[model samples]
Target: MTKLYTICFLLLIMAFGFLTDAAASESSFVDEIKNTNERFDTRAVPLARQVTEESVLAMEEYQGGSFRVLARKKSIERYRCSRCHTGKPVTAAQGLELTHGNIALAHGTEGPGLTCIDCHHAQERDYLEDKKGRKIDFDHSYQLCGQCHFRQKRDWLGGAHGKRVSNWAGERVVYNCTSCHNPHSPRFAKRFPATYSVPLD
Candidate 1:
């Protein structure tokens, strides 16, 4: 009985030895595959580097020439960032302190409520109209303002708010109302001058 038990233990040891040899053989095979892959990559390294260099050069050329010109055209407009909003004056009124452009009045830290994108949506065009013939034309300045300022428009229509200078007999093209009153800094009575005097100056 003891001899049979010893034979069974020897058979188990032989099975473990075979399993160990199989695992070592798999590990060696994987190492050889990795080494071959590394050698192939080394051979191709110069070609890969040349491709990368050409791509970078092409990118730089495109950015320097066409991209820069397009950026300048888009950015340097009549009313770049500060037209309706009053942080900076528009180009036409650059040096002037109190521009006809929208700025604040009657309070601390006030100006035009219009945002950059508010007027310049839909492919940076200020005006766009749909199929319904309900037109949106910002270049016709008063209409651009009239769209959002319904309350003011109502008053203008009812003859209560806006200043009516001369009753025209012809096609009544009124003044650019935004010229007199800043939509961002609306006033109740005509208290200050048309141009504001900076408090420090």
Candidate 2:
């Protein structure tokens, strides 16, 4: 073949190889996200299913944020509350209603209260980020919920809320929003009495 023709052939071969590599790389990246989501689903699905059991009661009709229990009542994979609300997995939101359903918190609180994401930054995108550029997913049950309930959060952290879940020789660890309040309207503690009460002697 002529020298110029041979050069042209080599150039074409190089372009083809580059394109193939790029496509393969993109495919792998998408696959990685899928696998990660699947693993997330495996851990989350059972927890979410438990939220729907008869033991848990519906908190309210409000629907906004990452996961809406009212919407989830229809189907698991079908619910799309995540389109607007970011962070925290979809399943976590689903669990909020049942895992931490509270009867009184929803109606009391003195006025129309806030939604779960109002304080909690599920993806950590709304919250303060780490120096490493990693946005820590705020467990709505604690970190995010603490933003507003400073005194209560402090009390909870110091072995005051319910019982302290702590390690020996370590500071106390408190539960997040999901631990107590359902994400729907009338936010309150799932475990506590809906209305406030004096501690028993």
The segments of candidate 2 whose C-alpha lies over 4 angstroms from its true place after superposition are: 1-112, 115-117, 120-141, 165-174, 185-201
TM-score of decoy 1: 0.30
Per-residue accuracy of model 1 over 1-201 as CA lDDT, tens digit each: 999999999999999999999999999999989878444455544421111111111111211131100111122244543345554435764654554344443322346544434444434344433333344443343444566676875565444655433343322223344446544454556576888877994
Question: In angstroms, how far off is 75's CA in candidate 2?
Answer: 16
Pairs of colliding residues, candidate 2: 87-123, 105-186, 106-186, 140-177, 141-176, 141-177, 141-178, 142-176, 142-177, 180-190
User: Which residue pairs show collisions in model 1?
Assistant: 104-111
TM-score, one value per model: 0.30, 0.29
In model 1, which range of ten residues has the least summed lDDT? Answer: 50-59
Error of 2 at 29 (Å): 71
Q: Pick the candidate with the highest TM-score.
A: 1
Q: For candidate 1, give the lDDT.
A: 0.45
